[model samples]
Target: MARTLKEATLTTRNARAKLGEGLHWRGIDADTHLGYRKGKRGGVWLVRWRVAEGHYHRDKLGAADDAITEGTLDFNAAVRAARERVEAVRREERAKADGVVHSVRSAVLAYSEMRDARLRERTGSEALRTASSSALERYVTGRVAGGNMEAREAAPIADVPLHDLTEAQLSEWRDALPPTLKASTRRHISADLRAALNMAYRLHRTKLPASFPMTVTEGLHISRKASAEAGEATARENQILPDSKIGEIITAARDVDAAGSWGGDLYRMIIVLAATGARFSQVARLTVRDVQADRSRLMVPASRKGQGSKPEATPVPVGADVLAALAPAIRGRAGGDLLLTRPKMMREPGQLKWVAVGQRPWGMAARLVEPWAEIRKAANLADDVVPYALRHSSIVRGIRAGLPLRLVAALHDTSIAMIERHYGRWIADGLDDLAAAAVVPLVPA
Candidate 1:
C-alpha cells in the first residue's frame, strides 16, 4: 500500500509521536524522505534525500514531535530545508569534480603540479624549486621532527576544505611546528603555503574569501615570533672557532689517528676542510687528479652552489705542509680513484671492507658526511662545534690574517655580501690596515 500525503502529514504532536524509528514517506518528492531515530531528547527527525543512485545525503532537521511538543516543526518547512541542503551539497560536489578549489589537499596538488611544470621548463633555479618542493612536502605531511613537542602529533590539515580553513586552525598547526626550526625556515614554509593558496585561486579563477592567505597578513603571529627568535639565536650562537681552538682540534684528530681508530684520514680531512674552506661534500668527492695537479689549490667539483657544466677549480692557496699531509693518499692512486675512502671496518665474520667516504646508502653521490659528533667528542671540542664551523673558522682566519674580503669569498665560492653578513665583525679587525693605507700626511695648506 502506498502512503499518501495526508497519511505522512500529521499536523498535531500527538499524531506524529506514534511514528517509530526508520524511513517514513514525506510525500514531498520521490527521493525525499524523513528518517526517525531515537536520541537523548526522545526522537530526532533526519531529513534524507537521494542525491544520486543508491547514494543519500542526510541532515538533522529537528527534534521529533515528542521532543518538540511546545513548537513543532512543519513537514513542509523541513522538506524545504532538506532540499536546500541537498542542492548545496550537489553544488559543492560539482565544484570539486570541476577542479574549482574545494579542498586544501586538491589546491595543494594543483599548485604542486604547476610548480613542477615550471621547474621542468627551467623557469626557476633548481635551489628555489627544491626549497618549494620541500616546503610543500612538509605542508601536506606535517613535519615530524624539529618542531615543538606539543605539535609533534597534530593531524595534517591537507584534507581540510579551503573555505572551511580557519585562522585558529592554521594558528594551531603553525604553533605545533618544531620549536628547533629556524625562524627564517618557518617563515619560508608559511610563504610557500600562502603561495599555494594564491595559486589555487588564480588557477581555478574562483572567488576566494577575503580571509584567504593572500588577503590576510596578520594572522601568522606565531610564525613571525619564531622567525625573530631564530634570528636572535643565530646571532648569539654563531660559533667561529679561534686559531688556538682549531689547533687543539687538529692535535686531537692526530691523536685519534695515531691510536689506529681510523688512521690519519680524519686528520687529513679536517686539515683540508679548514685549509680550503671547502664544504664536506665538495672535499669528499675529490679525486687523486684534483690533488696531484696543483699543490697550492684543491679543485672543487660542481657543488650545490656551483653553476656550470664543468667542476669549479677554485684556487684556494694552501701551504706545502697541508699538501704534504695529503700526499700519502695521492701517491700510487689512479687519477680516477677517490682521494678519501672510508677506513676498513669489520662487517660480519672477519670480512673487512673499505667503503667510499661519500657513499650514501640510498646511492646518492652528493650526500656529505658530518662525522662531527664522534670527532668533536674525541677532540674534546665544545658540543656546539659543528662540521660547518670549520668553514666559518677558515673564513674568520683569512679575514684576521688580512686577506681581502673579496679574495676570501672567491676562495670559498661565495659572495662578499655573504662573507660580510656572517663574518663581518671579524673583517672589521682588518679595517685598521685600510685606515693605515688611507692615511696620508697632508701637505702645508
Candidate 2:
C-alpha cells in the first residue's frame, strides 16, 4: 500500500506532526518514499527507494531536530535528498548488473576475503596465506611490507582504479621496488598479483577492460635483466657439507651439549637431519609413533610441500646411525609424545631458581635456525650454512655414493628433474663408475 501526501497540507506543522515513527509518505513515484523514524536522537528522516525489482535501499537524509549535529531536514530538503538518493541507487544497481565501475581495491578485497575463507575451511598452510597476503599488502594495499613486517607506506598504484590500471603504470610500480629484492621474490610477487586479478575476474564475473594487463611478465623480464646488470640476479647455490665438515659440526654440537648451555637433543636433531634428509618442519613435528619398530624407516607426515590436494603419509628410510641418534630422545616416551621438545621458562622463582617448563601444544619447538648459528661458527663452517644444508649434504652424498637418481628423488620427496638441475654435476661425477662397470673400450679390443 502507498501513502500519498497532498501538496497543500504538507506546508503545515500538522502535516509534519503526522510523520511519526514507521510512517512513510509517497513522493513522485510509488517506489520512492520519504519516511520518518523516532531514534535515540529525537527524530530522523529516512529515504527508501527501490533500485531494482523487489530490492529496496534506504538512507538517512538528516535529523528532524536542529540540535542533532547532522543537520535538520525540512520537507523540501528531505524530498530533494530522497530523489537524489534514488538516482544514485539506480546508478549503483546498473553498475553492479553491468559489472563496471568497481574499484581495484574493492575487487582485491573481495578476492582476499574469498581466499581467506577457503583457506580456513580447507585448513590450508600458512605459506599460501602468506603469498596471497604479501601481494595484497605490497601491491593492493600499497604497503611496502612482507616477510612478517609491519606496513610502512602505501605503494603508488594502491588507489588506482581497476579499469584504469595500465601496464605502463604497473611497470613503473614494479621498477620502484627495492633493488635488494631478489629476482625470484619479484617474480613471486608479480605472480601473486596476477593470481589475485584472475580470482577477482572469476569470482566477480566482472567485465574487465580487454586492454587490462594482469600479468607483469614483460616488466619482470626487464627487471631481471637490470638485476643481472647490477650483479643481483645470481642464483643461490645450496651449501653442501663434506663428510669431514659434518664430523666437525657434529663434534661442535656434542661439545655444546656437554656444556649444558643447551640440551643434547639439538645434536640428535642435527644427526637425524644429516642422516635422513628430511625438512626441518617435518622433523620438528615427529613423534615416537612416527618411527617404525624396525628402526630402518620413519614416516614423514604430510606438510605444506608434500601435501597436495589429497594428503597422505610419506615413509623415509633411515640409516642405523640415524635410528641410534633418535633413540635417546624417544626413550621411555609415550607413542604420542613429540620426539624433540625444548625447555621453556615457566616462571622466575626468587631470582635464584627459575621454574622450567617443557612442551605444550602451542609452545615453541626447537625448529628455528638461529640456535645452529653458534654451532656453525664454532665448527668454522661458512656463515651462510643453514639447517637446510644438512639436507643438501645428504642428497649430494647419496648421489656421489652412486644411489639411483629415482631412488634419491624418492628418498628426499623431490623430483628427478629437480635433482638433475641442482645436483646434476655432482651426479655426473659418479657417471665414470657406471661407465667403468657397464662399458668396455671397443677400440682397444
Candidate 3:
C-alpha cells in the first residue's frame, strides 16, 4: 500500500492542532510539498522538494501562523515561502551540479580552495594550507570539540542557503558555538568565516542571489567585553624569561639529550626556538631547506602573513651555538625533511607511538608540555614556564634592548600594534636613553 499525502487544511489554529503532533505534509505540486509539524507551544512550517527523481531535500521554513507572531506564516504565506525555498534549493542543486555556488557551504569551500592555492604559491610549503583545512573542519563544515552542548541536535548551519541566511540565523550559530572555547579562539574562527564569505562575495558576486546577505558581517564576533577579558588573560599568562634563564634551560635540554631521554631532538628545537623567536607552530613547520647553516641563519616561515611570494621570510641570524646544535641534523637529512622532529624511544612508554620510523614531525602541544617540564624543573625555573616563554622573552629582550618596534614585529611575524599592546611595559626600558637625550646641552642654560 502507498501512503498518499492529501491536501490538508492547516489554515486556522484549530485546524493545525487537529492535524496532530507529527509532520503533516501536503503536496503543493508534483515536486514540492508544504508541511506543518504540530507542537505544544505552536506548530512550525517546513518545505521539501524533489531535486532528483525519488530524492528529496527538506528544510524548516518558519513558524506556522497559529498565532499573530512576527514571521509566523498563514496558509497562503506558507505556500509562497515553501515554493520559494523549494525553488532556491533546486536552483542551488543545479548550480552546484554545474560547479557553481549559491549556498553558504559552497561559498566557504570556494574561498578555502582559493586561499589554500594562494598559500601554496606564496610559502611553497603546505603548512598554512593544511592549517586552513583543520580550521574549516573544526569550526565550520564540522563542529568543535565541545560544541554548543545544550543544542547538540541542531542541524549543521554549513548548508544554510545564502538566500535563507538572516541576522538571526547567523547569530543563532554564533550563540551556539562551543562555550568552552577561549574568547580569542572563538573570535579567530568568526573572523575566518567572515573573511571567507566576504572574499567569496567579492570574487563571485554575479553568482550570488539577490537575497545573499552581502558578507557575513552581522553578529560574527565575540563581544568587546569578551575580547578585553582575553587580552587581560594573555597579558597575565605570558611570562617573560631572561636570557640567563633561557641559557640554563638550553643547557638542561642538552643534559636531558645526553641522558638519552630526548635523543637531542628537543634540544635542537629549543635552540632554534630560543634563537629565532618564532611561534612553536611556525618553527615546527620549518623544513631542512629553511636552515641556512652556511650563513648561520634560519629562514623561519612567517605565520599567515605576506601573500604571493613577496614577504622575504626574513632569514633570522642565529648564534654559533644554534648553528653547532643544528649541524648534526643538517649534515645528514635531505633538504625537504622537517628541521625538528619528535624524539625517539620512551619519554616513558606504554603510549601509542605517533612518530613513525622515518617521519617524525612535532607531536601535540600537550605531549611537549611533559618534556618541557623536565627541563623547567632541571633549570630550577617556575612551574608556569613553558616553551612559549622563549618567544615572549625574545620579544621582550628586543623591546628592552631598544630595537625598533617595527623591526621586532617583522622579526617575530607579528604586528607593531601587538608589540605595543602586550609588551608596552618593556618598551619603557628606553626611558634612560630618552632621559639622556632630554638633558642635551642644558649646561649652557
Candidate 4:
C-alpha cells in the first residue's frame, strides 16, 4: 500500500513509546514520493521531498510547531525540508559519481599523479618517474584495493559509510588488524587512511562526518620492549652488539679472502658501519668524492628515508679503523670514481664493457654484515648479534665513554635527540655510577 500521512496517523497513535517513529511515517507524502528522515532526540525535525523531473531543482520549508511530536509536518514545511535534503544528496551523489567516472582508486593515486606531473615538469629521470608510478600502484593495491576486498568479505575499512559509522565501528576495524603487526605498523596504516580522507575532504571529493577515530598523536599503543623471559625484545635491544664481539667479527673478516670472484670490500663496509653510525644505505651510496681525507670527514650525500630528493652532505669523521679497512679496497677498485666497484663481467663484439657500482644503494649493508655474522656463528658468538648491532654498539660505547650526546650524534651524522631517545640507558648508567662515586663518607664522623 502507498504510504500517506493518513495511514501514518494511525500507526503514530499505536506507537506511543516512539512518537518520533509515528511522525517519521506521517512525514511521508505519497503523491510526491521521495524520502523520509526522522530525528527528535536533539530537536524534532522531519523532511520529505521529490526530485523535479528532468531538472536539478527542489522546494522545501520548515515546520512552525515548536514542540513537534507525533503530529505530521504541514504540507509546505514537509516540502521545504524534503527539498533541501534531496538537493544536498544530489550534489553529494554527483561528486561521488564523478570520482567513480574518473577511476580514482584513492586520494594517494590522485596525489601521485600530480606529483609525477610536477617531476616531469622538472625534467626528472624517466626511471624515477617509472619508480614513482610503481610505488603508487603498490600503495593503492596493498592499502586501498585491499581494504575494499576486506569490506566485501564483511571486513569493511576503506568503504565505511562515514556519515553512519560511529567511533565504535572504527575502533572495531582497528582491532581486527593482524595482531602480529607491530603497534607502529597499525599506527602507520591508520595515518595513511586518515590522510586519504583528509585529502578527499580538502578536494571536496567526500565529506568526513567527524574527526578521524584513530589519531597518531594520542591514546594509541606505544610498543613496549619485551621482557627477557618472554623471548621478545625491542628493536634497540636486538640492534646492539657488544664492542668485544664487533672486534672479533672484524678480526675474522680480515682473514676471509674475496672468494676469487667477489671482492673483500665487504670487510671495509662492515668496519665503516661499526666505526661510524652510518646507516646501510648511506654506506652503499658512498662515492670516492664524498670522502674528504684532508678534512678527515666522510660527506654523506644522501639518505634512504628522508624528506628531500637530493640529500645535503652530513659530515662524519673517519676513524683509524674505518680508514685502514677502506684503503686496500679503494686502491684496487675497478671503477676509478666508485668507493666500491664491481669488475666488468663481459664485453659485446662492438660494445665497450666497463666496471661500475650500482648507485641505488639497497642491500649493501646487509650483504657486508652477513659474512661477519657467519664468522660469529662459527666462533660461537651470542645469537643476538645483527648487522645493526654495530650501530647500537657505537652509540652505547660513546655514551659510556662520557661523550656528549650532541658531539656523538654529530660524529654519527644524526640528531642528538634520536641518540638520547634510543640509547638513553647507556647515559643513565653513567649518571648512576657518577652518583655512587660522589657519595663519600664524612671525614669527622
On lDDT, the leading prediction is 3
**Residue 338 displacement (Å), model 2:** 3.0
Select the stronger candidate by lDDT from 2 and 3: 3
Question: Between 1 and 4, whose TM-score is larger?
Answer: 4
lDDT-based ranking: 3, 2, 1, 4
lDDT of 1 by residue, 188-278 (tens): 6666666676667665544445446533244444343554445543322446787787777777777766665555677887788887877
Encode model 3's per-residue lDDT on 1-445: one tens digit a residue: 3346677777677878677677788888977888898888888899887756777788998887787667689888888999877766655654566564466677667778887776565344465554564566566676434644332232367887664566676777777778887787777677777777776666655555554444367657556468676554454433688788889989998887677556678798888889988887688778889988778789987675533453646688888878888877777879988778865443336767443244356744444777788888899987877788888988888887777898898889888888877776777766566666678565665
Global local distance difference test of model 4 = 0.53
RMSD list, candidates in order: 12.5, 14.8, 10.7, 9.6
**Candidate 4 residue-wise lDDT, 1-445, digit = tens:** 3333443331222333344532433434433332233344322334444454333233333432434544545444555666556645755565466454222245546655665575454332343343444433443334334634431232453344433334565566567767776665555554444444445556743443234334312322333432323444433565666677778777666555353233555566667777776776567667777666678777865464433354376787777657666776556445425575433335556878543333322233334555666666754667666667777787777777777788777666667776766677778987787788899888986
**What would the TM-scores of all predictions be?**
0.52, 0.59, 0.62, 0.58
Candidate 2 per-residue C-alpha lDDT over 1-445 given as tens digits, one digit per residue, 9 for 90 to 100 = 4334543223334565555444444455777777766544355677777756777777888776524435677667777888877765654454467655666566666667666665544332343353466467765565545687876666767666555556777788777777777775676666566655655556544444443443433433444454555554221354777888888888888786666444667677677677778777567667888888495888876554522352355678877877887777778889988776654545565576644465422122233456687788889877877777888888888888888998888777777987886676777778877677887678954
* Per-model tally of clashing residue pairs: 7, 1, 0, 4
Scored by lDDT, model 2 comes in at: 0.65
> Which runs in model 4 stand beyond 4 Å of their true positions?
1-44, 47-155, 158-171, 184-232, 235-239, 301-311, 328-338, 341-373, 410-421, 436-445
**Which candidate ranks first by TM-score, i.e. highest?**
3
Q: What local lDDT does model 2 show for residue 47?
A: 79
